[model samples]
Target chain A: MILKSAEAKPHIVVIGAGAIGSFYGAILKRAGCAVSVVLRSDYETVKASGFRFTSPLGDLSWTPDHVYQPGETPLQTPDYVLLCVKVLPGVDRAELVRSWLGNHTALVLIENGLDIERELADAFPDNPLLSCLAFIAVSRTGPGTVNHQAYGQLVMGNFPKGFDQHCEQLANLFREGGIDVNGTDAVVGERWRKCVWNTSFNPLSVLANGADTLTMLDAPGGEALIRLMMKEVIAVAEADGYPMPPDIIEKNISGTRAMGAYKNSMALDYLNDRPIELEAIVGNIVAIADRLDVPVPHLRTVLVTLRIRQGVDSAHSE
Target chain B: MILKSAEAKPHIVVIGAGAIGSFYGAILKRAGCAVSVVLRSDYETVKASGFRFTSPLGDLSWTPDHVYQPGETPLQTPDYVLLCVKVLPGVDRAELVRSWLGNHTALVLIENGLDIERELADAFPDNPLLSCLAFIAVSRTGPGTVNHQAYGQLVMGNFPKGFDQHCEQLANLFREGGIDVNGTDAVVGERWRKCVWNTSFNPLSVLANGADTLTMLDAPGGEALIRLMMKEVIAVAEADGYPMPPDIIEKNISGTRAMGAYKNSMALDYLNDRPIELEAIVGNIVAIADRLDVPVPHLRTVLVTLRIRQGVDSAHSE
Candidate 1:
């Protein structure tokens, strides 16, 4: 049931509340906003005990105001619905958010990959779509438990351009929860920048048989391979009219080295037999490169190998 | 002990007698040569029952005249010593062959990969170094038992260039044993031609998680990936002064499709945890491409991923 109040407070609904969503939703809740969650696997545990977060930002036990399973009707109208699910195969993001889209609800997608906003934008042309990039080291330790190991900075903006009041409001709410948030006019550019890392390490980690970032980086020619892929991605970005900064590759490499031994999200998914985000992360980037007549052999090679793996795996299952 | 013969025959010592060496050594023995083998893992089985072959070229069970273990001294080292071991990480081909190099024994290398002869050539400057490439589908089903499925052709020549009497004599002997053998003056060029297929498929099969030929070809974008890798290899070949035939890519693709669900040797090695010839196959190709400043990102990508797998596997063992 919707909570009745003398005055309506800003309400946020978190879709796909695994780790990123649950953590961010808790932060918004701490900022005095009413936060709800849509969950699948962790629905029972989270509904019973709420969320126990052991984080460097200080441990917190947050209980979402409302816990809703997927396929349920929209119980309350939300001012913002945070789409935080992985963009994997069979995940129709636009369809997932369609039923929950109220007239004034602005959808914010805090996910990985390039060219992710087009589907939602096409489905709801009038609704404001904000895209976000999360640079955080967080993982779900168990059901309803999240462990945040490192940085949690977020950059978000309006879909095709300029920042709006909705973006500003969300950024302020996130900041109030004690994490850094940047509301930029160039969110797409920021995505390309982040993709320079994602498109390389994510697929490489899986391809290397669940190797950690440092294992890959320390292997002979591993660093060069990463550098070449990043260069190809930067070329694709440049061709797509979003040229990255001059030192982006060095910055990315050094940043990854500083992160120590860490397995990327896709690698973890692969090891756990969960579907990886190949299309959204690498495939779309390769497609853009192909359309722009840019040569991205490294990216294409990774895409092809990963696709072959998926095909072989499905064939075995069949 | 040397076999006492009233009439002396060509004494052929076969080193690294796994599958390819065993089959070819059997064929040579069938051609009325005194064929001996150097075996490690299969020595007992081979010494007891010899080899049982099942091939469309006509099955034959032929016993070796002698089976010598590793570290044994030179035993009647004669006209030829065929080295057929895999060029894996720990294999020292030069050291393995050094003790058996008789003064008159011409060393014939029936192995895969380019630049493989340099180590032997550097070691035995006085003896004739003949390099041969085998295009065959052969596997050891059990110890001392080989199943030769298809095409057993041999291409042999002198190290630098020019066909000699030794090459012609070996070719004739192979032809007598019911297989085609081409003695070429441009054997290096022929190697580059064969590498167009090896460099593309071998590492790719492993990277695709032990995918067979048809599985890889039929996967979405798989054929395109192979074609791209083939083109890069061709580019490297051309840069290295060996321009391949115009239809090499198409011919290779079609020939592979006709092979029907074959897993390359490297893929089989990977699946069985046997040491793969990554350095000899994809690594050398990339090295040549890098030296020539050729853009072989596809090949380089495959090399990098495989190297990472090697690193990760070794780390786990440690």
Candidate 2:
């Protein structure tokens, strides 16, 4: 199934060479796995200079086994398919990877949003799927540069639960890659827990642009809004059949306070004028809240404000 | 008694010669009134080159009767004192204007805010206070230049009641100055009416920086928020003993829509890095809403966000 030994290295085709994809690809390469990447803006550069990774552990540069653009066909089917693209609404992602993915390949999705695994799993029900959570602070600084500022780990489990040997094999690949890879039987709980942090900080960081986690918390009355957002997320998650913990709000607040000044991905995206991960992160929760008849004024406000910004931008373009 | 004739021009003291004061002073001067100004930033420039008025009506440049700093005492009390300063909290306004105001000087308090009349009236009980509102698109472009783009009028009334002879006289002065002046027995009601627009646009224009009125209105969910703000303002005003009409929200929305692209004074102030009149314009309404036990979550959120911006600015300064 997965990687048996270092001699027979599993070949991985990384579908998105973003910060997450690059980080994982570099780690997998270091773990003695054959890694190839399909990139958007970084194909030419990565093919030339390779990936330059800067983490707290150390810094290293390495070239993957191969790099290809979207149109470039794969001559061979890889053992694992890693999907790390930004999951904005209206993108046909299942269609994007179908050309290279075969029946025998397993897919690992390491994204920071809600309900991202549904489409891929539905597209390939027979294929092995490991829904993964990448708890790492990473950013693609340049063409071949990946900066990991803080936490780095992979919390993975069998898609729809109950870990098998395949889960162990895939996670062991990451473990052998010089990063912690923890397994959980309750992946939905982990997703909700991750959403608890993402929903609170992501949109607020974008809306409250240029402010970090602590700076936003220190904002006047911001502490209350942040806390309310966390509570609302937990409530919405519960209503949606995956409840977060009771102490999660206090825990998140104190934990973020300790993280000091850190900009979430949404903030970075907004600053870079990239499309925000609104629907995947905040909109999904709001949709669930709407379906469940739960009032999440704070979260709803963030959603509406972002819609306004998007509307303004579109109007400007037209 | 009021002025006997147009030939007997009223002498008025214009304190706080910013945009509002300068505009009113220029208008009063155009109406054949002798206007003396106490200026802060524009003193030297205005002294060197008198005010240049560029309105849709005409163009004119004229020096006021006198220009003095705040420390410079007036030789004598004038017939009227136009208090056009920003009505922010924490400053002793009464004491600031005490030296220039005397028994017969009817002070027309031209400001944009809630609960402004009480303090001035309380501080100078015997003085005739005309609570006034300016409905116009005007801004000070430079040191001695005012840009009057659209809709110019003065809606005024006696501080606590029906129009007195002084109010009539002041109304006539503005009328002769080529501007319409409307009088009402219910000044508070009119204030609430004006607030329907101010509350919707002012802070939003600032917070949603670079966004004019229509752009904000055209924002995806801005229509609902704007309408809700108008409704909440009406409710708060009613709780404060001043009931606006039922269809005022629609009326305000349509009126603002028709205004096309116009930035509120608060927005201009924010863009220029000048301090916003948060306490005077929005905070006072939120306070009243709190007192009346009215749940105005939207307005309260606006208040808090502005406070957050203010807090961030203060922290940056420190």
Which candidate number would show the highest lDDT if scored against the true structure? 1
lDDT of 1 by residue, A122-160 (tens): 988888899999988888999999998888899999998
Candidate 1 docking DockQ: 0.80
lDDT tens readout by residue for model 1, B276-316: 88988888888888899998888888899989988988788
Using TM-score as the measure, the top candidate is 1
Off by more than 4 A, model 2: A1-7, A158-166, A313-318, B1-7, B88-92, B160-162, B313-318
Task: Determine the backbone clash count of candidate 1.
Answer: 0
lDDT of each: 0.88, 0.81
TM-score of chain B of 1: 0.94
List-wise, what DockQ does each model earn?
Answer: 0.80, 0.39
TM-score of each: 0.95, 0.91
Score residue A221 of candidate 1 by CA lDDT: 93
